[model samples]
Target: MYRSAIFLKISLFFILLILPGTVACYAQSYKIDSLSLLLKSHPKQDDKRAELLLLLATEGMKFDPKQGLPHADEVLSFQNAIKNKNYVASAHRTKAGIFLYLSRFPESLESYNRAITVDKILKNEVGIGAALGNIGIVYMTQGKFPEALKYFLQALKKQEELKNELYVGIMLTNAGIVYTEMGDYKEAMSHYQRALSVFKKYKHFVGQANTLGNIGIVHSKMNNLDEAIKYSKLAIQIGDSIGNTRISARENGNLSGYYSKQRQPDQALKYGSIAIQKNEKINNIKSLGFNYQNFSDAYYQKKNYALSKSYALNALKIGQEVNVTDLKRDASLGLSEVYTALNMPDSAFRYYKMYKEYGDSISNDQKKNEITRMGMQYEFDKTEAVYREKQILAEGQLKQQQLQLALNRAELQRGLQQTALQKALLENEKLVSEEKQKQLIISQNNEKLQSNKLNLLSQQQRFDQLEIRQLWLYGILAIVSLLTVLIYLLNLSRIRKLKFASTLQLREAEQNNLKLEHQYQLSESELRAIRSQMNPHFIFNVLNSIESYIMDNDKRTASRLVQKFASLSRLILENSIKSLIPADKEWKALRLYTELEAMRYNNSFTYSFEHAPEISLSTILLPPMLIQPLIENAILHGIIGQAITDAHISVTMVQSEQTLIIKVSDNGIGLNRTSNKTLVNVVKEKSIGLKSIRERIKLLNLQYPGSASFSVDEGPEQRGTIAVISLPVLGVGSGEI
Candidate 1:
């Protein structure tokens, strides 16, 4: 929780810092002020004036992204006088950037499209490549990875054709990020390596550092912490040597993260402090956010939660100010962790919920396979555009809904005002009638009642404890008395047996006694075998899962699983040795066992049991603890990872011709999934419980020919498993079919 809080805080800090920092790095307010002064002094509707207008807009945007929107619009108006398609395209591109930074995605795309159209008409390959790259970046911000990658690849091809070395390296790096996001680590590394080579060959120190930083990120995701640290240090060294403050600051944060992950709090703090100092020097607000987040991580590792919380808050504030989803999501998550470390649950919940909302925006269903088809190729045809169009239309509809919601809130506010006025009148009436004073007196009496209730509970607890002690004493006395009575009865029986018969009669009785004792020994052995039905493997797996939950600090899930497992185990042990149990008791054990497995596997399938129409659960009998292993097999191999929505299992029992038929059926992947295994391996790995059941079936058949049978086969649709067993009905004591 503490670590997550730190990351979330840092992300937000970057967003807020970057919000006012992007254009400011290139042109301070003084440049914009001079441009504005020039514009005011020279007012002429011509080419020179249009240039002046664009210059002012571009300069003014340093302080605020929207500051140049009107100026750029005026520049576009002078296209007739300018007579240069290149200049017009440049104006559209400039306008698009402002909208992009403002998160006006639709406007940005439309402007970029206009620029592309002009570039295409004029055969401006460089402009086309640049616009395409920008478009891809916009798609990336929206989490449309496939669409982003498509454009980036196209831009890379064009840049290479044009011999634009810098853009080629940038495009390769962008593609690497898309691959990384898609979880293709090997492919991502390949792209990063190529990009790094290109940057090094061209002597682009900053680009080389950036690619190295990306490689470090992939290594981090793959859990190669040492490799991550190695690459990060190399990146930082390059950036520092070249005096690239921005790259240096970002790499320091990366180094700090690796050190924190390694549990080296001192080393992490050292790098984090360096990053923060460097960011402050450059007035890089976004970098400070990243740096502060590293501080949060270091402090959390040191167990200094107060400082961690402070840094996390700063990161979150910056993220919100910058209006970046990544920043906001991470900031909220980090903040949540910080609050959790502080033992503040409410605050933790609030930030965690915020994190979930932002995360969903990036990882929702549409971004799955559907993302792969978005804006295929560089050309925007009707068929290829359906996905992007739908996304844009949906976003627009959501915006309208938000606007309507604001209006609804205004109406609600008015209603609340009216309700408050009515309540005020009621309060005045209450004051006149002394009702308020009566209510206060009643509240005081309730408080006194609460205290009395506590006292009563304490007294009741004492009485219960005394009664429990008396019951224990009585139980011990009863056991002692019963043991004495049993000894006396045994002595009397022995005396009765002392009266022996004639020699021949005694021999005959002795033979009969030997037969009965041999039978008793066989029954005891069978019962012990029944006790062996509990699978050690299954029990061990359950224990392991419980241990994992505890290790993860998931107390709630661990406690719940442990309780269910304990109850199910108690039931199984109690019933396993019984010759016959009530049908409902066996059915309940099966249900509980299935529920435990289902919970362990995330409830990937549904289950049910069906009893014959005329069957009475109370009257019918079933062998105890005999059906659970069959269901467990179905859960593990049949449908454990199946994705179909209708996957399920059904157990049915019916009586026919004095024979009880039981069938366990499952709509699952079936046995073919294990076709690759040898037959011997399959049987051993598939269901050890079934092997035990086969032995029990053999023992049952020895009593009467064809009295019991079992078989496994394909279900109705040949897409699942069906196991059937037949047992002859018997009278409890007589044991007659």
Candidate 2:
């Protein structure tokens, strides 16, 4: 049993060393020239230069480990000159990764400790988590499984605190690797499963591939070859789709071994060759050694002694160069088999002795006892399941708190509304009273002036008639009667003019009040539109769908859905901030929103857009998302509500001289089922999207009076609804600023 344990330990350590790691994923494809240019532009010893240098070093570490060391050294040398501790910490972390890649365990551990100290001083949680994980990797490589688990768990705790799902997944996978090597397959699988959940949640493709590949390895160890092949292929597929060459190579190598175990030598050879080619392309020496060993194993299974011997020698060369203990052990085993098959007993015995020596080094009593102790401790704690229970409880508490906060916000909004209404009422009453007071004063002044004018006219007549007394007495009396008639006519005309002027003033005041009321309505409608854009129901439904995917363990789909939802929300927010946007921008936002809505509801309907060739979408400007509400109503009411099958919504744009016309038509249970009248007629009962559309049109027309118009009516035969919006052509499309 101890001998078997020794062999298993050596083999597991080799597998861990050869497997592609999640940490190296951050070194994804980057242009060295771009980094060089950036560094050149930033001056020597500058913080920005140091930052870019670290990025370049990170990118180079996995592929060219030696090249990255000098870059890391340069960063450290410049750190004292730079003020930012975070940069210095990142530099140390980069150096640690390079040393780990080069198999310098002690050096890597030292650098990681330095990084941790700097990160602690800077309070950099993420950096600290990374350094901890790196240190753990070093310990794991050195066959210190329990010690590695300690570091991994510590890093995981930090990752959880930061809520960085991707890093958390990476740490979980690392812990699982440790457990697997400790002969605790059950605990290993549990951690891998949890890691898969997190990777899927965030759509971390590299992490997903790593976790899947590890699960396959675990299954392979359990002698479940079929299940091992299933997961290995899945890992390969994900890696291929995401263009992760290194991960794909590692999975292919695993598959090759799996097929070889199943005695499918031909299939084994095919995947082994593929792994070799990919590793060559990436210049991955560690993975190359593993691939070569798998190739030797496949050929050995086929009884091809000569070819098997050649491949084993190749693997041994790489193993010797890299100095990985597990690789050399596996290589010796393969060479021994090749020699035995070739009928060379002496050579076979010599290699077998070397393999035994390697196994002996791996199975020391202290290590075996440590593995047993850690496995027992893990089984007892059931840490992951307990953590999940705690998480679920905390999530429930958070939801309750959020609900209370929302209720409080609603109450505050209601209070503000009441205060505004009261203030408006007071302002209206004050204006009305002031107008009445001015009218009363004008009436009193007019009456006094009229009385004075009449008295003055009478006095002038009396003085003039005395001079012409006896000779023109009859003429004077006739003139006084004519003057009296004239005075009465003048008074009547003045009174009529005053009444007409007062009526005009009253009419003006009424028009002003109507304008104010319309303005208020416009504002209310805009607020409603903003609220609808951020409708809680829609958000809740999207979140529910995402939750469903998470429950189903379909992380990729769920992550994609979340991304689309976020993009739609961002567009809505940006549009709300702008009164007008280019037609193309509005179309882009509407299209994204339509697609997201369709996805949320399981693609129950489809949509398309048609723009007139003559219209320049980039130059034409319109109110942002003006037509989205109408489209939403068409889908929600006309299509979804009515259970319309194969429903299609079409948006068409046409430019005619000085006017731009947009039409939204949907083939669903048309206007006859909903309403026979235009959308305006049902405004009182329709959604805020529709009501806001109406109010917006009114406001738009006021701004450019008679320049915008919209009408909603039943389509041909009333089979569906058609909404048409017309706006004055400001100019050719100039694109959005």
Candidate 3:
């Protein structure tokens, strides 16, 4: 038994060196080698071998599920043979992972519970955390996202404390994917971005690609196609660079969908084909199914009804084989669309009905399962409460017994005192009798009285000693009670300080969040202003042209220009009141102003608004009346009274690095070399609009610090003022500054 204990401690020491999520093939081989040595030394080392086998099985599950299952079975058999309860618990956990891969969810759940029980008995925190995380994965696979999230969060707290960054990133990405499925894009993006940062920092290329792919999916859902494309391309690039076929295939599918949504059918088809080919090469059933669905959608957009139908059917078959309900739903939707396009009403209706039924059934099943789980949880909590109550009752009984024992001791002490008092009285009487006898003789009478006085003095001394002992006992008890009170007060003061510190930390975090939100809002407002300014430049230029005609004494042309300028000014003023105007309306205002400005300069200067299809003017919001000042500055500084017939201005809005980059550049003289301050400070001091923008940016910085920025510089490869404002990409529901 002593040798066995020593061997077990040694094995555990080696296990501690193997980090979670890093037990690769080589690590498993090392563990196996160690197990063989242990078996040779201790011929009856079945239990130790079983413990090592469980770890080996877990490692194998990552690469070879079939091989892992046999290892798990072997571990379980050894545990049963040796009747080792500790190994039995761990064997169940290993078996659970194998069962999960086999899609035997009920058995997996049971095995996980068994592992949890054993871990609890062993006080194994890491094992408990792992079991919970695996259970969460099971829930996720069954489409129970909320339940999965609960367990995942619990596991995450433990893993974070353990500083298991690799597993932490994986869990974060999983949680984010669940949120994406639930349509909580903002939260999903936050998690995915955090995971991406971790993966990049750790140089985990595959993890980075996966996170980027998920981020792309979120942006796609939010209708930010350009951002979706950007992230998807990044994922593809990283995956390709790392030679990770799985990530490459997945990203290809994402890009296909992004291109299809952007109405780029040719690019969509190209990527969809690449995804399918890569998935085929890797034999990834999940990726293959998504690839087929993407191809079907791309084909449908291209009006290839026959090809669309074929791909959709293929996707449906793959989805059903894999039991991927979401994929099946998408396939059905795609088939319905293809049939409708082919003008087959009856066939289209059939697929549509099937799609609706499947969707409803999935939803109903989820709701029922959630209700059942909640009921189970409530019962478990009730049982726990009852057990706690019993524990408390037992403790109370023990305390009562202690108190009774103390009381009995005090009573016994009093009884002893009474007995001593009786003995003292008897002795005193005896002494008095003896004294009386001695005093009988007439000549010895005085000597007998002196002896009686001496006996009384000895009795008084004994009584005083007893009194002192009683007073000492009372003083000790009083001091103990005072000391206990003092200790409690000291503890209370420490608790108060802790509470204050916690409150202060919470307040600081809230203040920081508020600051970030304000900064985001300010950046958003500036973007709107830049967009709004695009229109007024053309309007003012047209008015200037009409002034030129009036000075030239062309009354008819001047009158006609005045009428057009008046109408344009009214439209601009009306549109300026809105946070966002239609792209066409903004274009019209820009055209009118551009024309007027051209007439004023005899068509020597030119300007244009370059629109990207990615910019959805209707849904996008900008700050009202923000752009005119910059354009005015450009005209006043760049073109006015200048001999530069080649002068031109351009305004562009594009999203890059999760920031909306708005640039206003011109072919004009650069900043005055004589200025003592930077352009930003000069704007802050002299320009009301710029100052307002700065104040707004400051407020936004409070909310989204370091997320948005603005700067004024010469355009790259061009000699002109470039006023650039970079705002974080905010969603539709995001409010104005």
Candidate 3 residue lDDT tens string, 1-737: 00000000000001211233433333535654565564456545465566556666655544444556776677666565754565666667777766665556788889888888877887777777777777887777667767777787787887798887866887788778666766667888898888778877889877777787777777777778898789888878987896666567667777777787777778878987898787676555655777777778777777888998998899889778867677777788788888888899998999888788778877886676556556756987999999999999999999999999999999999999999999999999998998878667655678787999999999999999999999999999999999999999999999999999999999999989977876567556655554545444445557676777789899898897787677667766677555445445655665565566566667677787775678765555444444556665665565555567688988787867567676777877655521223543443343345665666556545556876676778655556688876766665566542
Question: Lowest summed-lDDT stretch of 10 residues in model 1?
Answer: 8-17
Better of 1 and 3 by TM-score: 3
| Per-candidate local distance difference test | 0.73, 0.75, 0.69
- Model 3 off-target regions past 4 Å? 1-64, 81-111, 157-170, 197-207, 236-246, 265-286, 321-323, 361-737
User: What TM-score would every model get versus the actual structure?
Assistant: 0.40, 0.47, 0.42
lDDT by residue (tens digit), candidate 1, 384-495: 6888889999999999999999999999999999999999999999787797688888998998999999999999999999999999999999999999999999998877
Q: Which residue pairs come into collision in candidate 2? A: 618-733, 618-734, 618-735, 619-732, 619-733, 619-734, 620-733
lDDT of 3: 0.69
Q: After superposition, how far is residue 637 of candidate 3 from its true place, in Å?
A: 90
lDDT of 2: 0.75
Tell me the tens digit of each residue's lDDT in model 2 across 1-737: 00001111111100001113422332344467777777787777876666677767755644556667787788788778877667677667777766665556688889889888987787776777777777888877666766777787788898799897777778878988877887789998998999899878888787787788888888888889899889888988998897777677778788887887777889988988898897787666766777877777777777888887888788788778766667777888888877887889999999999988876766763487466676868876898789889999999999999999999999999999999999999999999999999999999899898999999999999987886686588888899999999999999999999999999999999999998887677667667777765677668878999999899999998999988888888888877766667778788878887887888878999899889888878887877767778877877767775567879999899988888999999987776676333543453254575557877888888767897888889888768889999987764443223
After superposing candidate 2 on the true structure, give the runs of residues whose Cα lies further than 4 Å from its correct spot: 1-31, 59-68, 161-164, 320-323, 365-737
